[model samples]
Target: MKVQVLLRTEGELAVVVGEAEGETWPEMQTVLPALLRGVADRVEAHGEVPDAAP
Candidate 1:
C-alpha cells in the first residue's frame, strides 16, 4: 500500500509519501493507519497544527 499527503502552512508547502507491502488484508489495514499516523506525527512535530481555528 501507498499513501501521500500534502501539507500547507503559512507560505510553505510540503509533501509526504510512503509505501509498504502487506501479505494479507488485515496486515494492510494495520499498515495503512500506521503510515497515516506517522505522517500526522511528523507534521505535528514540525508545529504545523494551528492552535486556533482560521
Candidate 2:
C-alpha cells in the first residue's frame, strides 16, 4: 500500500490530510495512527526552543 500525508500549518495550528492507494480504508485506519505517531515522536525528539523576548 502507498500512502501520502499532507500537513499544513497556520501559526501554532496544524491540519493533516492523508491519501492512500491500493489499500482499504480499514487498513489505512491502522497505518495512519502509526505514521502520525512516528512523525510526532520525531518532531519531539528534535526539540524546539522558544524565541527570545523582544
Candidate 3:
C-alpha cells in the first residue's frame, strides 16, 4: 500500500496511488478512514485550533 499527502489551497488531501490489485473503492472505504484517522490525530496535535469564544 502506497500513501501520499498533498497540500491544496482548499485544504489537505490524502492521496493513495497504487496499481489495482483487485478491490478498489470498497477497500478504500476501510483503508482510507484508518489513514484519515491518523492524519486527523496528527493535525489535532500540531495544529492550533481556535477555541469557542463567547
Counting clashing residue pairs in each candidate, in order, gives: 0, 0, 0
Winner of 1 and 2 under TM-score: 1
Write the residue-wise lDDT of candidate 1 on 1-54 in tens digits.
443445556877665555677677777777787677776776677676877222
Instruction: Quantify all predictions' global Cα lDDT against the true fold.
Output: 0.64, 0.61, 0.49
Candidate 3 TM-score versus the reference: 0.43
Order of the predicted models by TM-score, top scorer first: 1, 2, 3
Candidates 1 and 3 compared: the better one by lDDT is: 1
Q: List the residue pairs that clash in candidate 3.
A: none
In order of appearance, the predictions have TM-scores of 0.50, 0.49, 0.43
Instruction: Give, for candidate 2, the lowest lDDT window spanning 10 residues.
Output: 45-54
User: On a 0 to 100 scale, what is the lDDT of residue 37 in model 1?
Assistant: 74
By lDDT, rank the candidates, best first. 1, 2, 3
Candidate that scores best on lDDT: 1
**What tens digits encode model 2's per-residue C-alpha lDDT throughout 1-54?**
777765554665454445556557788787777677655654556566255221
RMSD, every candidate, angstroms: 4.8, 8.2, 6.9
Q: Which stretches of model 3 miss by more than 4 angstroms?
A: 1-3, 7-22, 51-54
Model 2 lDDT vs. the true structure? 0.61
